[model samples]
Target: MRRLVARDERWPLREAFVIARGAKRQAHVVVVEITDGVHHAHGEAVPYARYGEDVPGVLAQIDALRPAIEAGADREALLRLAPPGAARNAIDCALWDLEAKQAGVRAWDLVGRPPPSPVKTCYTLSRAAPAAMAKAATANARRPMLKLKIAGADDLAAVEAVRAAAPRTRLIVDANESLSFEDLQRLAPELVRLDVQMLEQPLPVGEDAVLQGYESPIPLGADESLHTRADLEACAARYTCVNVKLDKAGGLTEALALAQDVRARGLDLMVGCMVGTSLAMAPAMMLTPGARFVDLDGPLLLARDREPGLSILGSMIEPPPAGLWG
Candidate 1:
């Protein structure tokens, strides 16, 4: 029988993490580990309040699944038993880790894929006032690219401010489903003039149908707009790119499958993250090869991260450490 272990961690953020939903003080993550007699593996996921998950609830669910997991539950079967949330994400990742360890190969390799190379990633400048956002962008001007998070009407000011602050750096604006059609229309010209590379999830998930046949100054990416493969067909006509997060997709099994399907459908890939530790970001690196942009800077937002973190060189993400998962 396999053994399962799990725990919750509260990693304090270096600064308040603000978004359309709200602000976050800590990145509350739950990590799961699975071990057979000879090998062991681990996975991490954030318990998001927006998703109706809490630490206690996730732990209880994992406890209930222990017997089934030890009795030989494959990832597909595990999904059937647990709904898509942090609990399942943790367990799914741990199983992938265990399999990779047992096979003496990286998870991606054992899963039948090549390793991802170093990729240029976007360093995020969280939502702030126009002046502060400009200052933050100026401070990070050395980064090859930057992703600016905007919340509401001040978005134009925020984007313009960041643009002026980092004139040469490539820019991507993520409204996090906060903007309206009116806002996008008004800002398109400015975004184009500013040379913004992409606009990510300008509207809420269900409201994205409004973007159908819409002409955007830049390609629009799906963040909350797309989750699983089931969402792909519906989003095809509405979006040019898909942002994949291991947590939202329920870890590597589904994330890899989704990435493959995304490429097959001629959609650009963007590997992103919730505020998390390197353990979470490490597994996500496997999905970065075909990514148009990577935002695995979760570790950078944390006051402190778990040991042996990924190297963030300016805006480039380096390879994961050996034994940090695939």
Candidate 2:
């Protein structure tokens, strides 16, 4: 029989992580470990309140499913039994880890994908006063790309501030579904002027249908607006790209299929992450080959991380270290 262990951890961020919705100083995540005989594997997920997930609730769900999961439940079975959320993410990831351990291969290698190498990624400039945001961008000028988070009417100033601060860095904007139609229409030209490469989820989740008849200079990506294959038709009509998060998509089992489907539809893809340890980012890094952007900097915000972590050089994510699961 396999033993299942789950726990909650609150890692303090080196600095406050801001977005249009609010600011955060701590990243709360839930971790699950499954062990049988001498083999052990682990998985992690951020308890995103925005998605109606709380640490206690997710842990409870995992505890209830421990017996079934340890009894050799497959990823699909885990998804069906737990619903799609942090609990399922942890369980799904744990299964992948176990498989990797038994096969004596990294998860990426087992999936027929090359291990992660250094890849340029977008570093987030969270919402703040224009001046403060500019300072943050300036400090991170060496980063190849910057993903600026904006909210409300001050967005224009935010973009301008970052552009001025890091003139050479490629810029992307993520409104986190805070902008209105008027905001998009008014900001598209300025975004172009600032050389913003893409815009992510400017409108609310279910309301992205507004982009059906809209036109903008910068490519628009779906994050909160798109999750599973079920969201494809509407997302296809509205977005030029889709951001895939393992937690949101269930796990690599589903994310891989979703990526293939989205690519077939000709949409640009981005692999993103919630705030967690390198354990979370390591799995996500495996999905980067076809991605136009990779936002696996969740561990970068943490004041500490799990031992034997993936390295982040500026905005580039290095390959996972040996013994780092996935």
Candidate 3:
């Protein structure tokens, strides 16, 4: 019989990660390992509080499915066994890794995708005062792209400051469900003037209907408003792009399908990640081949990353080695 193992780990951040929701000093993650005596594989995910997931709760969820997983429930069966969330994400990715090792082939090969090339990821500037944000932007000025976390108030000032600091850096502003329709309308023109290429989740989830007929100067991406394929139809009508995260989509199994569906529907794709370690970001690289944006900078924000992590050269992230995760 196959054996399954699950545990929680905490990795401290280099500095506090502040977003519209709040601040976090460390990443709390759930890790899963699956082995069949001879071969082993691992996966990791972060339990997001916004999704009502805590480390203890996610651990419990994984433990509840231990029997089924060890009983030979494949990735397809996992979809029915657990709802989309951090718990299922860890298990699903672990199974994918296990399969890759068992077959002696790379995970991307099994998925029928080319090997992931080194993709340049956007360095994130956490929510801060305009001056502070500018300082952070200046520090990362050499990076090709920068994503700023913004709230409703003084957002324009912050973006302007960042633009002035890093004039050539492509910018993406994420409101994290903090903005209203009026806020987006008021800021879109100013953001465009500041050369901001995209705005993410500016409006709250249920309020996206207001954008159906609105014209935006900058392309808008759906994050909290779009989780999986189930949310495609509604989100496609309102947003120009969708940000896919493995944890939000449950795992690579669903994430790959979601990424393809997003592209097929003519929406831009952005592969994003929560504040976690390299193991969490490793599986997400599989979706970056044709992505319009890649935000797998989680490990960059951490004080220290797990060993056998993906090699990050400057802002470019290399794919995971077989020794890591798929």
Per-residue lDDT over 1-326 for candidate 2, one digit per residue giving the tens place of the 0 to 100 score: 78899998888998899887889999888988888878888888887888887889999989999889878887878767877778888888888888888888888877787776788777888899889999999999888888998886467897899999999999989999898888888888889888999989999986767799787788999999777788888999998999999888877777888889989999999999988889888777777887888888888889998887888777778887647775
lDDT string for model 1 (1-326, tens) is: 79998999899999898877878988999999888878777889988776677889889989999999999998989867877667888898888878777777777787667777888778888898889999999999989889988886567888899999999999999989898888878777788888999989988877889889997877899998777788888888898999998888876788888999999999999999988898889888888987888989998889998877788776677888766764
Q: In angstroms, how far off is 107's CA in candidate 1?
A: 1.3
Give the top-scoring candidate (TM-score). 3
**Best candidate, lDDT:** 3
| Candidate 2 Cα deviation (angstroms), residue 77 | 2.0
Q: Per-model C-alpha lDDT, please?
A: 0.85, 0.85, 0.93
TM-score-superior candidate, 1 or 2: 2
317 Cα displacement, candidate 2 (Å): 1.6
Each candidate: how many clashes? 0, 0, 0
Output the lDDT of residue 4, model 3. Answer: 96
Clashing pairs in 1: none
List ranges where model 3 is wrong by over 4 Å. Answer: none
Clashing pairs in 3: none
Worst 10 residues of 1 by lDDT: 317-326
Which stretch of 10 consecutive residues in model 2 shows the poorest summed lDDT? 317-326
Tell me, what's the RMSD of every candidate?
1.5, 1.2, 0.7
Instruction: State TM-scores per candidate.
Output: 0.95, 0.97, 0.99
Q: Which TM-score value belongs to model 2?
A: 0.97
